[model samples]
Target: MSRTLPALRVTALAACLLTGAVLTHPALAATRAAAPSPAQQKLDRLADQFYVARAKFDPLLYATANGDSRYDDQIGMAISPVVRAKQFAQYHDQLRQLHMIARAQLPEKARLNYDILEFEINSQLDLEHFPEHLLPLNHFENVPSVLANYASGTGSQPLTTPAQYRAYLSRLNQLPAWIDQAIVNMKEGIRVGVVQPKAIVMKMLPQFQQLRSSTPEASIFYTPIKNLPAQFSAKDKEELTAAYRQAVERIGPALDSLCQFLESDYMAAARASSGYGDLPNGAAWYKARIKNNTNLALTPQQVHELGLKEVARIQRQLAELGPKLGYTGPANQLPQWVAAQDKFKPFHTEQEVLDAYRKIYATVDAKLPNYFSLLPKARLDIQLEPELTRATASDHYTPVAADGSHPGVFWAVVNDPAKYSNVGMTSLLLHEGVPGHHLHAALLKELPLPDFRKFYTEHPSAAAYTEGWALYCETLGREFGFYDDPAPYYGHLNDELLRAVRLVVDTGMHAMGWSREKAVAYAMQVLGYSEARATNQIERYMVWPGQALAYKVGALKILELRAKAQKALGPKFSYPKFHAVVMGDGTLPLPILEAQVDKWIASQK
Candidate 1:
């Protein structure tokens, strides 16, 4: 998953440059010079209103994540039924307000904005039908894990000043209520047969147990106090430390209580079945997820078939490459053979693993200008995934701070350096770092887009565009000369194949009623993943249904658009220009993206 942050500083020169680019950019600059119509003005007002209103429900997410400090002392009760109901009602109201606007009369940019806002409002309304709040605690994403990241002083939550520290302490004070609410929701889920899978509940137990330290000093929440700025007065430092300790003490029991409930009552009620199809209204729910994530009206059966075809297509490429690497075996067995290679496991230390990624970064960074005309102003940094979440987290990109306090982070999960395979390092960095997420996301922020468009919290509905673009970036390895070697190229294919496999397995589990074991076995067989890797990936899909499908679904659409542009423009085609057309609008749904590309193609002709 990726996050977006506000721009650090818009220098006069930078602003002028942005203005010039927008005016000249083929995809963005409207041909008409007409002033805003009544509908356009109304649309802009509604967009601003929607952005501000949406922030109220999750001020911590909207403010802290975007570098706004106004809500620093607050963590809104998103899990509360009353709060959710209000938000749900707001979604309906927003949709109605959007409908009141005459979209056709609006300018092109305003119309696009209106369409996107409409899409978002409707997506939220569709999701509102499902009781997702009831089953909020999962192994992959839950409140405890999010709070731990903030308390660690390394995440979005800033802990620099006394006020920031107190703000976090205030948030800590509210932890018990949130946990209590989660329990209430989970119990209701149990009553309604919307409980999580037993395996996921078992996985979550350890995460909660990790939060129960004997003393506040030993807890992850104590990190801010330990790292307090030297500029702080002795009194301030001492006072802050005491407060954090007390806050931790209060928080520990809430965690313990939640864990105990999970172990005792929730565990007994957790469903043995894996798929959402097993739950009430689960089939329709899964279909909605498919539409949300893919942004294409694809059926589960359609996505599954697409995955099968992609698997075969990529496997043929892999089989051809395997022979070049002296592995003349079946395509399915190539991954196992590659994994066993000693050369691929050369790193013996964590630093060695990180250094390898950095080396790939340097190599890719130099070639970026050749393929992209629009690059992010924010720098990208590579780091190891934090210890608490490393076990379950995959390599991911964290956005840069809005105030430029933090650079974009590509967290490489190095559980064991010796076991870390170097085969996928280049492709992974491309996807999570430059020319992928960091490049796509940071550039989007720098664009003159609305806050709603640029900084809305990443949702599954937008995954098709975001994840799709990142996945497509992985293929740029060939163009960058990073895949000159057969090893990295094979790794790229494997990664692509992984996404293709996700489409099959995710839909199979959620929509087709495949067992968890069945899905895991299928991934292991097709991807040559170890039992653990396969199980972990399958479990992630189980928790986040339809999310895994976005990568392939989005990537394929972009690829299709690119192919269409290339065919239509012929000799007029440019990689950088094509990329600008795809990314120039920030993140967009597939249909909108295609429309934008078609407009660009015609403009060129």
Candidate 2:
């Protein structure tokens, strides 16, 4: 998952107010003159305070990807015991303040804000019981891997100005200390019997090896110095380059040290079990992830059953398409056969793969206005992922800065293009680019809210909100006329079916104690996934737990809301307005999103 992209803030489309005779009516004029209620006034002040407090405490929250320069110099010690204690204190204080608010007395919008804040505070407090910092480094997401990417000059941390370069250099110098602390935390995790699976620990080895370059100039950290802005004075450029090279040299030992610790100390202690079910409080931890990721109260068993039914349903559909694709095999074998077809893998070179996706973007962009009344002002950029991580990386989207300073990127992993297919590229563009993450994220900044609402990039416990919207956008291809062809349309189904499989397989391994092999086999049988793909997907679920389930859960909720709105409005239903309601607010929990849709439905009548 490309979780690094900052949400873009586009210019809000102007809405014409209800004008003419209504404005002049004496009764309406008198109503408009009334002041806000006392509870509403207090709620407004609290909201402002809450937003400011978050920004002040967690500077890295916004500065990480949004190109917010305010916190550029501060490399927050997110794992430090002192920092954790302070954060917990803040959470407790905020919760106390939140409890004092008269939530019932406030307006609906303010009440929703209160609910979101209350949920966020309590969840943060709940999470404190687990020592997450102890088991921080994973193959999927960790500080070292992320820092390596940021240093490569292509990631969210911008290095355009000399000051920006210097700021990052300060952050760069913290690498050795950070690595030392991580080793200590890992040692603690091993002592507490909370280590990562050996399978994932081995995956981290290659990443550490990648970061340990022989020289400074050869390192990814030298990227900014190499591409220094032409406007810099010769003396300043020389000094900055030297400083950056020195920083990279210092970081090399840290990378090597961490790598050595993992190989020598951590690897032997790492557990063999793949699921969270084996650890102490592992079940409760997994459940917390389920709640946070889906933002719903569903039990793991319920989600598991839902996934099983969805997989069966999608498999039945695949059987229907099997004969159409000239396959007469049993339904169980159909996925393997479809995956082996030569027609799907047409691109021979990386450029060919890039060109195919570019064409898809062009086609989708042309027809977007037909379905959406509001579109992002920012355009999308298609790029290939960095070569080091490309093989294992998923095709993902990274949002441009909200100020439109940077363009939103749809990064496709292009290693071994022969194994990859163009069949799903169009659908991929729809989900990652147009109506999916790019459009959804880009429009967040244009909303009428405080900086916290637009720029608070940390609350992704609402994964369902973000991933679900993108997944839902995948279905729009059919309505927009891009997936009329069977191949592309099936691509859409394949993606959807994969998400459905995640709900089953994620809960299966973590909650039901299914072996990794069993889960992989099920995916290959049902989703037409190759062994490598299936294994990778299952392993992703193994390490991340419930994160993958967010897509299907969220998309289903959004789809349900759309269906309900359509039924309520009948022929009068406006798809554009419905979308506006969904994207109008920044990312939200499904229940709040449903309430928003219901409110819109009522207003329509």
Candidate 3:
């Protein structure tokens, strides 16, 4: 990836050719107006330099994160702690430079440049808090585990050619060292309190063991190698067949070694306490995480309270829908109804499930113009989750590339038809498909932001605002008259209630110090979620604290803003206009999003 331009900087070129702030600025030189100042040119060059660096980083980061290996050569980019530290300093320095230049020199549309700088700085700063390299592999999210899935010729890892096949072998070779370092970091985490919960570690045991069992061809990840490209020369095919066998040899043993260490050593000493607060200074660190993710100053208690209030509000809405369907009693019966409804049961086959979701997409796409004045340029596709990782994955959406080379993918984890609920698909589609994440993320990608702002979004990509908007889209089915069936309508609310339960249970687990049993029990009892589902979710929260809280917190904030916008504008408010205004800004901090809508409303008035 190119980090530098030949001589002419990217920002300078933009300023000179695009802005014409340089040569004869039609007006500037005509009025004898101040020619482009020397400082302006310098700032332009600097901005261009940043863009060039960003352009280089964008595709590489994308390739890697998306599971592509175009930049495998850069895999050791952060290998050394000293180099990592230097990278952190470099990030801070760049952020400082942008802060000064943005506040003083850049134009208004370029505000994203500064915002992205802040995000990058925060990311780099946060990296120093834990020595994650010490523990390169964890059960919850590790390269070995992920690569096993990737090598299955599913997900983002390409396996179309012999070269790509070799790439996988090479990456597999790197796993042992990465996992070794990961164990060390995890040990450090244990020393300092950053370790994963025993429950999550338990789940990983089965997974790594699954990796350990293999005839090379029998392994789940080896499926693609077994089905090598038909066009490959016989020699290449034979060589690839051998490569797969070789991969399983190293990969299988490495996984077994790591699993043994984690199971015998790490899990044995794992914390009895589950919350991030239990770690050393974990309380303060969690608070930082809360701030980082929600972009709100809310205490856990406040967020917890918000969840309770939202639960009540949503249950009431669900009750209204239930009565209309001639199913009455308490409103809370819907999740149970969601589970018990025969019509809502899983499809007999995977294609049935895919078709079901695809129909939802088509239906929603047809009606999108009814509710949205703006639409994303990127397309969305429905695909099964990668074989390597499907068991753990629920449905998820990946954003389309900013350049539109790829379409947004809505991955359905159809590993078990038994657990799939007919009631949940509506909410899943509304949130993960069109008019939800696909729209939100793709639009954010395409927005005319700085190269930095355009691509890099981590946990705090403003989940509440983004995810909240998606949740709100779930409710919009009612607004657009698309919830033609009571089951689908309730399906949407069932998921809403599920999220509400998360508010209670996530806070229950991390902030309130509830044990896994207590958390799972409360979920099953109050929310009607099954024990298995509850166990998985509880373990998930155990591994990644404070993440589940973001969904409800984010959804409520968006709902709250929508109400304010509607009430403030009263008769003048238009749903389409309101949606456009809210979504027009990609992902803003909750308060910043509030200000964004407030400004939009004031202008409308």
Highest TM-score scorer? 1
Candidate 2 C-alpha lDDT tens digits along 399-487: 67765546778889877878777678877888888889888767665544545556633355667888898999999997887666777
lDDT of 1 by residue, 136-197 (tens): 78999876687788876666676777877888888888888899999999999999999999
Model 3 CA deviation exceeding 4 Å by range:
1-63, 66-84, 123-127, 130-138, 161-170, 213-224, 232-248, 325-334, 402-406, 570-572
Which residue ranges in model 2 land beyond 4 Å of their true spot?
A: 1-63, 66-69, 104-108, 456-458
lDDT winner = 1
Q: What are the TM-scores, per candidate, against the unseen true structure?
A: 0.94, 0.91, 0.84
How far is each candidate from the true structure, as Cα RMSD in Å?
Answer: 4.0, 5.1, 7.4
- Lowest-lDDT window of 10 residues in candidate 3? 1-10
Poorly placed runs, candidate 1 (over 4 Å): 1-38, 59-72
Better of 1 and 2 by lDDT: 1
Model 3 vs truth, CA RMSD: 7.4
Residue 183, model 1: Cα distance from true site in angstroms: 0.3
